[model samples]
Target chain A: MKTARVIYEDGKHKWIALVRDPNRPDYLIDSNEYLVIDDDDSLLLDPGGNEVFPAVFSALSTEFDPRKITKLFASHQDPDIISSLALWLEFNPQVKCYISWLWASFVPHFGGNKETFISIPDGGMDIMIGSQRLQAIPAHYLHSSGNFHLYDPKAKILFSGDVGAALLPPGEDDLFFEDFDRHIRHAEGFHRRWMGSDKAKRDWCQRVSQLDIEMMCPQHGAIYRGDQVRRFIDWFSHLEVGIVKG
Target chain B: MATVTQDTGRELRRIVRTNEEIKRVVATAFKINLMAMNAIFLAKRAGQTALGFGVLSNELRRFAMDLQKQMSQLREMTYGSVNTVTALVKQARLNRVLERARKESSGSGRSLIDEFMRTRHNLVFARHREQIAALNRRLSQMIADTAQLVELGSVLARSAKIEAAYGGAFSTSLMQVSSDFERTIGEIQRSLESLTKHQDATL
Candidate 1:
């Protein structure tokens, strides 16, 4: 029982996030799937693993005709990010998958073909959803060596992928972060262990700091909205990442 | 400058055809099971004169039902494999589009490609392609199971025909019918075996 909620909306151009499934197995890691709908076109970001496909697919179908999901964005080649690809292709084989050019050849192992991909350059580029432009910003080495985040300039929302993803404790399933300090505690260990490169983290923080982002949506845990978004960037900038003490 | 590859379209069509064939095989197996049940009912009406035929019919029906279950499993695996292929082909095409754009965009697209090619040749493609190959092993198992069912059906048919010949003078028609039943079952088995072979090779 997964639920899709409209997290950001401006008429036909909207951002919908599909969150927690009560029926999902406890052994598997939880994930949040985002759908950016612009008029008739829709792009699904980090749709998630094969095990969660049935729930994600059913939930997506309920919101809109799943067939309208014209594009897919994989921040990196992780199975949890793109493994449900084969199942999604079963619904519409022609849906193109957007990924970093680095994992262009690699991600297919999870499921996808050449035509099904739209490779984002290492620097990232603007992807068109109907007439609207969605920027694929470079967030490389946040966790994956070849990662990019989706940014909607019109909505001023940055889909940070795993950069701000937090693996929250049980019984905390809020959609947006109300307590920034408390949420950062859950994310600190993840960033330290998974961020991998201090230089990459600094580079990403500096670049994104320049943007007029109102909301920071991650692939897991609560989203950061308004002033919390600015606070998150400032906190992340000064923090030393990728050095594991334990 | 990204030209669509002909290989993907052809491969997708092949998957569609393969799924259709799997459905037909399962449907045919169910029909054979029904015929086997009818034969058992006729043998029952004939009483002790055709007791052997009744037992053989029951065995044939059981085998047919089992084959039907196996065929259903095969169908499921085929759908899974085909879906995997569909995704692979689609992704490949999208990769080509980006590669083409990178080549044509002068230095603009080169940044993405250059950085991406930095730590290259991970062979994730080969790993994913193995999933499709695994489906062939699944098909092979189905073929082996069907071969065993066919052999058992043949043995039962021969035994039933011999038993029919021991009938009374009024049982001549029953003997002839038993032989015809054996031939029909043999023909059906041969046809199914041919189908399996064709599928095994194509898949």
Candidate 2:
């Protein structure tokens, strides 16, 4: 049987959670927190953006222990992503919170206790869990104040924040895209509305292109696979760098 | 002109989506500035404000106003002329013809406008430098005044013969306030330098 896709619907909690930089509208960004259960160590990616004590906590409790949550990962230091970090750390004292080096000060700024943080500057860390290895490819500040993307190389799963995540229609709840065009529209609308720096996003797309992606786990919208990710990147590459282009 | 049109068109395209983005950032920064100014005012009203040099609150109030007056002069220089990035870009583009002339001609040391702009820029920089230096001087005077005020307050606090031991206490307190005020000024200067640099770069 296919693995269960545990989802935490943002509903209205996702406002300008990912706002395109005022200077650039083509690059989509905003801090997003997601967790993936990959058989071994429960990998939490960008965990502090949304209030996790209830939604994310209940979602993750299905597979693992909140106390056994050894790894807490984040892309950057925006409050949505890092503010509620203290709340996350309260459940597990041993959870080694990880964030990008560029926003190390950002953690402390959010009252994240200095003792619990581990700095990871660049991407490409083959961090091994029980059996699966997560290849964290660096996705820098494209739209948010600070940002990154985490990928599970083995599962071909890309945990991309604010990338392809779009507001689902009234009653729809499918995370995976069946049609490529539909997914592109969902992704593009958000990107155009809340993008960051085009140059930075172009660099990010180029960097992640090396990875063989199958499923994209975006923070806001549904997931995409294979060629759709490339298509999104292509369309995104043409958008304005800092300002919105009509 | 065609190239300019193309570039401007590209910039206009970039502007559309950034409407939301720009508004939000500008709003946030404005909010922070307002908050900081309000906090400063609230502290002053509460009488919880600490002077740079241990001066009485009223004297320091005057000092702050004086410093503000001096800082306003800085704005005159900053927004006086087109010293922004857009202006610089336009200048560079216009200077291309003059640059070619300099390369081809035997006697093309500098054009009249070139010399004139250079002099004008020097004047701007000189004015800015004076204002910055004058601000620092005013702060120094403020600290001195504060120190004297603190010493006077301390003397009033003492009883009997306020002559012998008071001198020693006054000297120490004076030094402390003066040093603290100077350090505060240094920090202010550093913050201003960085903010001004960012303003210039972004513009």
Candidate 3:
């Protein structure tokens, strides 16, 4: 059974990530689900779609009793990112999902009522988990038109959603990338095709570079920790995204 | 699949009912202590003539006290089991809902379909099922202990009856108290036996 692994923790605050299931079928793209626990409340980020609900739900149960999850954050309206909205809402209707105001109406088509969402304006907003504040940084058109990345100032950990994701090869199932140069090859093709604009990628890299981030976490592949955080930013800054290369 | 869910729901309800029954047994156990205390006082009134009966009454009082402590432990365990069952029921319901949704869905929404099937194979329900199994094991052990308590009470009751025969002026009253203790213990034994059997089938 897939269990939650605590990726980061300090006192009452902790970041738990449910890793990709090894037995997951070849056709489906692997995704990671994260739980940010602060005191008594927890916020689930990019909790994945309905298909992975049982796994996600089961992984979450290991760390949290069902009621501990008070909120959810969807990076964009991707089915892989938030399609499990309806299933999660079923488990916890009171859980408020944070998403861009643009997808406020569109994402609910997946599964949400008027009261279920907390719409972040174009500039983005600060979300409170218990007493701790987490900033939602805008990543518009990196892929989705109105996407966001979560930043925890206390942990200096940035949950970049699909921003740093890599499609890892089989047998190399490590959680954190030990070598950044080797890891970028897996992420390069995904960023080129999926990220909609070079301008958006530049804007995101420039903005995130200024933050003192220790670890850059992606939804799909291994995390970039320590100096690799800077290496990823520098590499993404020069990369030509959204272009059809021969 | 629906049948499995229905059976699970029914089993959860049965667990809840069993917890309530165990609570009632604990209350009856409290009453047994009261009866044992009264028997102690009746023996005291017969003075030196009922000294042997008095000794047996003291032993009965200690037995009742020990049984009460064990019953409290059993009640605590039962309450914990109820909570575990409630968690299992929640997981079971989610699984049933996901299965139904998967069948009803189709099309270019291939990711969504994959997600439903993915969740079905995930470890969440399996973990809860494991927890529920552990709870059943603890409950079985608790019920087994209650059975042992009943056997000990029966032996003590027989000893009290033999002592009551030598109680002189308080002989009749002492004999009556011993018989009452024996009957109460029998009722407790029957209730615990029924509980164990009920739990056995569910486990």
Q: Which candidate is the best by lDDT?
A: 3
Worst 10 residues of 2 chain B by lDDT: B156-165
True contacts kept of each: 0.00, 0.00, 0.03
TM-scores for candidates 1 onward, in order: 0.57, 0.46, 0.57
* Native-to-model Cα distance after best TM-score fit, residue A163 in candidate 2, in Å: 2.2
Q: Candidate 2's error at A15, in angstroms?
A: 26
Model 2 per-residue lDDT tens digits across residues B1-203: 24543543443333222233323323333333333343334334434222322223234344444444444443333332213323433333433433332332222223432453365446533464454345434433433443344334233223111221222434443344433333444444444444334333323
For all predictions, the C-alpha RMSD in Å is 16.8, 25.3, 18.4
Candidate number with the higher lDDT (2 or 3): 3
Candidate 1, B116-169: lDDT as tens digits: 323221343354457766776776677677667767777876776787675555
Candidate with more favorable, higher lDDT: 1 or 3:
3
Candidate 3, residue B55: how far the Cα is off, in Å: 99
* Clash totals, every prediction: 20, 20, 6
Model 1: DockQ score:
0.02
Of candidates 2 and 1, the better by lDDT: 1
DockQ for every prediction shown: 0.02, 0.01, 0.02
Q: Candidates ranked by lDDT, best first?
A: 3, 1, 2
Whole-model lDDT values for every prediction = 0.76, 0.49, 0.82
- For candidate 2, the chain B TM-score comes to 0.29
For residues A190-219, write the lDDT of model 3, one tens digit per residue. 888888788889889989988999988899
Taking the tens digit of each residue's C-alpha lDDT, what string does model 3 give over B126-155?
666677778788888888987897788878
lDDT of 2 at B166: 29
